[model samples]
Target chain A: MTSPPPPSGHIARNARLGIVLFVVYVIIYAGFVALAAFAPSVMAREIAGVNVAIVYGLALIVLALVLAIVYMLLCRDDADRAEDVAR
Target chain B: MTYHASSIAVAVFVFFVGIVLGISFYLGSRARSAKGYFAAHGQIGWFVNGVAFAGDYLSAASFLGICGMIAFYGYDGFLYSIGYLAGWIVALFVIAEPIKRLGKYTFADALNAKFNSRGIQVAAAISTLVVSVFYLIPQMVGAGALCTPLLGLPHWAGVVIVGVVVLMIVVTAGMVSTTWVQFIKGSLLVIFCAILTVAILARGFRVTADRASIKPVAATQPSDIPFGGQVVSIGNGDNAVGASTGPLGPVQFLQKINDVRVVQWTAKADAAHPGTTLYTPVEKQAREYMLPGGSSTFKGVRSPKLTDKLDFISLMIALFAGTASLPHILIRYYTVKDAVSARKSTVVGIASIGFFYILTLFLGLGAMTSGRLDPTPAGSNMAAPLLAKTFGELPFALISAIAFTTVLGTVSGLIMAASGAVAHDLMENVFKHHPNENAKVGAAKWTALCVGIVAMALGTLFKDFNVTFLVGWAFNVAASANLPALVMLLFWKRTTKSGITAAIWVGMLSSLAWLLLSGPAYVNIYKLDATRAIAPFSQPGLVTIPLGFIVLVIVSLMTREHAKPH
Candidate 1:
């Protein structure tokens, strides 16, 4: 259990955002790996020209890049707003 | 199959090496102070630092090992890229900003910042050194592996060349030159791989006329040969079609691999004749190779055995956890300015790294059908460069040279992290030696020198090994040793100095011990019976990582109030 995540400030908000985004990554990555392990037939099935395994793997990679960008945009904007308020 | 030396490869390799050395010596002048030397005075822009992150993180293993594995094993090799790139998610969301805010020079600095504990300093320092050295072996070995293919030199010569060049780079200009080198190297490596991937898509699958009639092994030898695999007729069939897909889209390119027949080799040396290399040529179904678990190493994904599944899961966990915890990667955050910049840079790294890893799949598959594999099974590390040679000698030289720079970028970061541990963590924090900035900088350079020498020496010692798994072991050690402590320190308030210290040492030693005593080490390194191994499984992360957390939580609970020195 996490220790009552810092009294709801910007840091806390960013941390919460990060944690949620991290979960998104976990879901995508874990789902892909689990599918690979438990469902080879599904993985081997061709979607378009690529196998489900390849599509999912490449998707997970793209999803990570997207997540990183999303996190950066969210936090960077928040950081700027917080700075403006401080000023 | 022995690799022949190419003059073109040698010339191009030398040119790249010269440019890197020139850059290092030139940048050496700027990094006089401790901050400049260790962290580039925190002046590097986020974008460059991020590319350097790609440069630093994408070690020889990623470029050579992953590509080689994919070339040999198919979908299983791409799994490493997935696992490796996945680790960056942890780095980006969790560690990047916090590490930038926490530490100054090294991972130990941030770790000890909260408690100012010598125990934390010593533990973190030792962990950095151990993890760095463990990581260096494969990189150096990759250096050697490339040499045999590019220059026809013995393995040790490549090892020495890389070691000496990297030492010069680190000692001359610690992080400044390293970052720029990595940025340029990282950028070029990505672009080149992208080019190669595009080339692969263009020059797509060419099915052999008699694609179905290849045997996995020509003959089964007595189970005594240690390191030889010779496939009789991988594909003697005439070209049914030329190796060109005529501008197929990426998806179409991957999909087409399932319809082509490829020859993949498996090398196994038996106990009776370890020197006798027995090679089996296996005709792989496109569907099989294009799908996951193409190699025996990743068999756990589909295996019925409980231990096998656990092993795969454990390896994935380690890869997921290891990236944020790696000392060199952690230290890189300190080279950037602020948390936002660090986050942005991490995004850039993720993008670059993700794109490259994606390319590795096509490059590997392209190599699978290239029919240019070194007849010797042991030379898988040269798969990508040799694949490049399929197009032309110039691209081969370029890929090989860039691969060397890949080693340099990574090795320099590792050495920088290692030397920082010695000077910043051990000498300054643990010993409480408040030396002036210049003296500390000087000590760090000397430490870099020593660490470089040590790395170079270690590079020579661990030659001719499958670096992919060795890198996995390094990741396990990093994840077990550093990830738990770092993550807990960030998230948990109850984490005491004692708890952190105990967790690190226990995690480090226990995991290391477990790895050394594991089944693979017994069979592979020691050349002994696998049953003689003490550890039940090869990977120690599933056990040691939790043990680290458990020990931390318990110790933290016990000494919640007793915040004493001892």
Candidate 2:
């Protein structure tokens, strides 16, 4: 923060990207939790072989990893692009 | 279930303890300065530190308590793992880079860096110590849990062993040793947990073919030794017997387990004895056993009662908020060299942690149907280890010992954070007694010793409850007390020193007060009636976390003009 801020568009892009991913994750996770809370029997329903809760739970965990990977790569690209613009 | 310590198991446990101590001593000579002692000279590799993140973050409660809960109750225990792992999102996105950039040594450093307020320093340091101590309780309780079956020693001995070993690790090499211990142990925890899960998949489910009556074991105390129930019948009918499944895949493991019936031990009020409990074996469908509302703790998830639903929601909030705010996890940011490395490590941590949590589903379900676990309500914490007992003694010993080191790693991180609070933050900063690096490290050693002793005493004092349940209290306090101040300071520009100070006190005290008066604590620790508890539920995060944010906002607005530029 002591340093000068990056170009406004660069910062905005990164912030918007980060916020979007975070919200996506929250909704994905919270949707599962909501299902568990309100309509647990729905969670108890079987898909293929696994229960809906198990399937949803596993998906959330896997989704978190994918999103983390996505964020890391995107942030690194943003940082590199900002550095290039400044140079 | 009572266990006799096999010579092989004891030998394995001893081997682990010695190896850990040896690593500590080897690292001791390297950490000479406060930077070396507290932050490992900021020379650690990003990947190793990332793995160390897994080690530091995944306490025994995750391994022992979650597995036990899943083993006993079903899918609800996995709920804790989900919340805990999801919290890393807050840490990775919001805290990791800024924390690395801001702090030189401690969490307090980053917090007070903006204004250099003695008030923020003192308050932040106190907050760190409180959170660390509260977190230490479950780790110590987990140490005892590992000791009982692995060594055949009493629970207190297990608590004392981790206390001493972790103290030596902290006093000797500080963060350098703690980080590596976490790194190695974290790696081992995941690897071995994978091995255990594979073993579970291979073994599948075995039905208890015979109906055996479990006799009264006299009046039960709350912390009574684990009780294993016999297989009364395999399926729904009394005639459904000899139902066995073999080498099932992950999905088949669950579906196949649905029809298997098992006897579970439950504690009931003794008709003859007023103040004592009677142990009774009850037969249950395995399908219901793996459902969300299986345990008394989570029965409210589907309960018609509003209080139960609120309790569930409150717990979820605490778990979500706790990770970003934890002093132990926050301090790990300093171990890496740069902000990028910090983020890298968090990603690695999330992946590693996420993988282990997935494995816990199989492990818990495995333990649930392992036919070895004591199906008593209280024995859920021992699920993973006892499940390991199904295969052989060697795996059980290794799992128990590794789980014990899980405690050791987390507790050492905690003690390091707490010692830094006293030695670096309180003494060097708040009091203006700027000791040289050597003196600071020496003071830290003494402080670590003191904190370790306190943790041992508290761990022994609190028993009879699952380690995960105790961890919920710690998470609530940390999220409520620490997260608001840190978040507002970083984002909300109006945050003033006075506001930070007031929020910390208000948040910390209110959560602690609510905890003491909550039903669980009143019934367990206070030896009083839980019904008399004034609070609506046990968890305080729902009310207190929001309160912290609101208080900081109001106070900061009032003091906005007084805020000086850095």
Candidate 3:
């Protein structure tokens, strides 16, 4: 039987990266939720006649775009570093 | 319940189902190899896969559940849209590329990629199957609901029809047919809903107080009609009553809401005639309510108090997180070619899904004031279609047919995902029972068959419950069980096989336990007094999601010294 292998150093480093990103995500989401549940007036001024709930609803639209850019940068850097280590 | 099966509606629905089947057959014949059967040989076009993502992701809850919620509950229902879309951020940023790179067929494959442990396989596959089936029930029920009106058939027929059609879709092309079907359904669902939304906005709110002008049949009496239910008396009086022509015919309504307050039918019994009930539309005089001012609009807009506010917020969190973490949606990453395509397709999916959700806001509110809300909670499902009926039978037929197809698209995607887990993940990898390409395809066929039966049984058992309500429980389960493990596995290198396995097990069991013992489940499903519910909070994401993370951290710490050296 093949012996079990340990996670590579790259994998370990990537894991750390993932933790930081996740914490960031939780903070952003919590902030958005607080604004939506509590700050309808700010939302109303931003979008006329729109409920805070609805504007907060649009937060996902903004979040998706931001997350896409972040993923590309972080994952590409990690992949490049892994290649360098291999060489 | 009335048999107004226009030949045009029947013809349109059958034609749609037929085209989907034809595509399935073509794809099935091509899916002879295991690679083809499991992942479409990773050859699916990015555009097609992207739309298929919408198809697979949308499901019955997105279509029927959200619409029903909006129609009945006002702005609260749209909160689901927010939650579901928000979850995708987690998917796109965190899981997509890594999932594409690591796994070949199922989510289990990716989890066990580094560990190569059989326990991980079993744990992950069990979660996949559990979540997939939980998701499938609502799709089947939605099919049954749509079929009753669209095809003028019974509930079970709709369930069977969807099951057989979906099974065929899976057995024929595997992912190929499933993907294309989803693409077509997804595109059409969004476009048509957009049209409906426009129609809704174009025709804004109208208030009327004509209490007796509108006439709705309350009950149908046995006249000379051959059907299950029919109208014997057509009385214009407010308390006129009727019975069904047969045992199961549509019971006509005398008093029904037609864009105003509740209408109550009062019947006075005559010595010879007994008493009869008639329809009377009630008028609601505007009463001043307090509006609390704040964020988007009303600085102090008068809305209901603390309980309503909490319920609304809870629902939004569930939708936002739920979308990113669904088992069915996560599994779609494997079918695409590479990471870039995965990200691109996700963007397309977000656009399509986001657009459709916005449309639901209109469709739902349209139904609310459509003045056609059925009094029973069960009838709430018909809000959108009934609203369409107010416009004309043609619009009603179109919406009903689209609703049926919505169920079909969602159910087909779910069955395909569940079958992949059985064929590719559990059977080949964990059990060490490798089948050839042909045999693997055979296994998938059988898996789809078994899963179809389970879905049907669930649909029938949940026949009385609202499909949307059941879906929220599914979202909670999905977010809790799968999200913790997936997130930890991708991000934490200290995540040992034991840690990952424990996270999944803890997440799955705790959420399931919370759901079973929660107040809502107790009152709605168990038929027991809600006060007996064991868990204080119903939504498990707040608790089980954190518990999963903690368990992983603790288990990893304990096993660190014994960890294998790199």
Candidate 4:
């Protein structure tokens, strides 16, 4: 049979962290969608030789990766601390 | 514009399929147990599972559909790339660890973990099947698209070949073989596309005199410029062709294209010839070509209509919310040992997928400026393969073979999810059957075969729709049906069994109903006037997704007494 889930405290901590990060991402993503829908001219303006649409799109992809790394690192620390407490 | 089956392409395709089959057969003996068949015994390494995630997630829609869209429509396709990758953020952050902890075989297992209610089991399993079938259409459509250029076969033949081959792969070994297949193809796809991107950068934009060779036709008169013909004119004059900007930087490539005018085609009813349509080239400024709304699919972004704008937002929202809720992707977390492995693998998936999406921009734009685009509506799916052909026949063969594998990897994952829903969730859990291990495996294999046949039929039926657009509808259904229950179950303390059950049904049915009555479905599926569509917008997420959440909360409150204390 499969083992039980991790301690509720640990799971709860991770859930809190995850939800916070998810909200941040949702806001950023919403901003992109809003601009594309409402302000086409803003997205049309060129930045660094490419338009803002391309730049912002690339940024969203990059930011997701960066945040993923951050979440992973922070979770690892939490796991390590939990281990210490258990010991 | 015409594609002939090359000896080299056929050989490479055969070699790729042979190797993939060989792996499945070798793994078949090891997957005799139900656990082995369904979840690879939960022993997959985090890294392999991670890349397998990339392999499974980057469907034919990502490789062929988006590239084709960008080739024809510019930045709008990349918008799909961005939305698709961002959905993984939801996957990585909210769903990964919890799903890994709860589920054993299928997504249904996770949803039914706390309650063990037959209602949840049935609802979630049906959702999995519905979502899987919807998702399979795009992969099957993609398979048909690839077969034409790769084997010089008709679209139906391609769909059939993929159906038969994917069935063999799934029925033989299940998740063991599927994971490895995804890993292999995922790595190869990324590596090859990176190579293709570098080649694109090196070649840059060349001012060709092909347009000058063609005699200009009046707007009222029929033109001889066939579909897929290059009509780009550089410099000041209408027919003027300037010097090549050799070996440009990525940024410089976009800047250079800003000075060039691209000819986009629009099809209208023929005035002179009855029962035939005429495709006329309309030259567009660089800004119009490079910006968002260049294609008909995303033209709503630049439109004044509120419903049009809402359609665009709904599509993006569905894509963002959908990734976390996909049955196939959720099941991948079960392939790994524990929640930590699930987390680690999701990070790897995000990194690989994000990087590949970034490459899609370069690859799509490369096809756009390659002077080799097939401008016909049907030709958009062939953009990437044709772009590779411009490089040489060998690159074309390799990319086509890899594109075929992209279809196989995703289709196998979807079928696995479906079969698990049938055998593990529906028959065993919901129906309360205590089947032996061998019997369960047998049931799953049978389910795989049946699903494969259904996918093949649908693939051929929906051959004309863009694979990416079809995938968007699948996303809309998946997100609306699956996301609300999943999120509430994980986060809310008062989520009851009835809430989960009611949410899945409400979400799944509402989204499906909305889609069948939407504008796109009216024109494409029903063959009726688009103006007669009942749904206000083409995409259903904005209405249906929230409806899912609200229904769940109200139902949970009403059924509060049914909740068992933890």
Against the true structure, whose lDDT is highest? 4
Model 2: chain B TM-score relative to the native chain B: 0.95
Error of 3 at B83 (Å): 0.5
What DockQ results do all the predictions give, each relative to the true complex?
0.46, 0.40, 0.19, 0.49
Tell me how far the alpha carbon of residue B420 in candidate 4 is from the true structure, in angstroms, after superposition: 0.3
In candidate 4, which residue pairs clash?
Answer: B228-B375
Model 4 residue-pair collision total: 1
Candidate 2 lDDT over B1-566, as tens digits, reads 55677677788878887998899999997679888999999888989998999999889989999998887778889888888998888887777766776788888898887778899999989989999999899899888877877787898999998998898888899999999999989999999999998887877666544554345555555345334534454453544344556677877776777777666667677788887666666677777765688776777788987777878888888998889999999888898877778878899999999999999888887777666676454466778888887788889888888888899899999999999999999999999999888998999999999999999999998867898988989999999998999888777766888898889888999999999989988889888898899898888998999999999999988888788666
Query: Which is the better candidate, 1 or 4, if ranked by lDDT?
Result: 4
- Show where candidate 3 strays beyond 4 Å: A1-29, A35-47, A62-87, B1-3, B207-317
| CAPRI quality band, candidate 2 | acceptable
After the best TM-score superposition of candidate 2, give how far the Cα of residue B441 lies from its true spot, in angstroms.
Answer: 0.7
For candidate 3 chain B, which ten residues in a row score worst on lDDT?
B248-257
Docking quality tier of candidate 1?
A: acceptable
fnat, candidate 1? 0.61
Q: TM-scores for chain A, candidates in order?
A: 0.77, 0.73, 0.52, 0.78
TM-score of each: 0.92, 0.93, 0.81, 0.95
* Tens-digit lDDT track of model 1 for B474-534: 9999999999899998888889988999999999999999999988888767999988998
The first chain of model 2 has a TM-score of: 0.73
Q: Tens digits of per-residue lDDT for model 4 on B166-189?
A: 999999999999999999999999
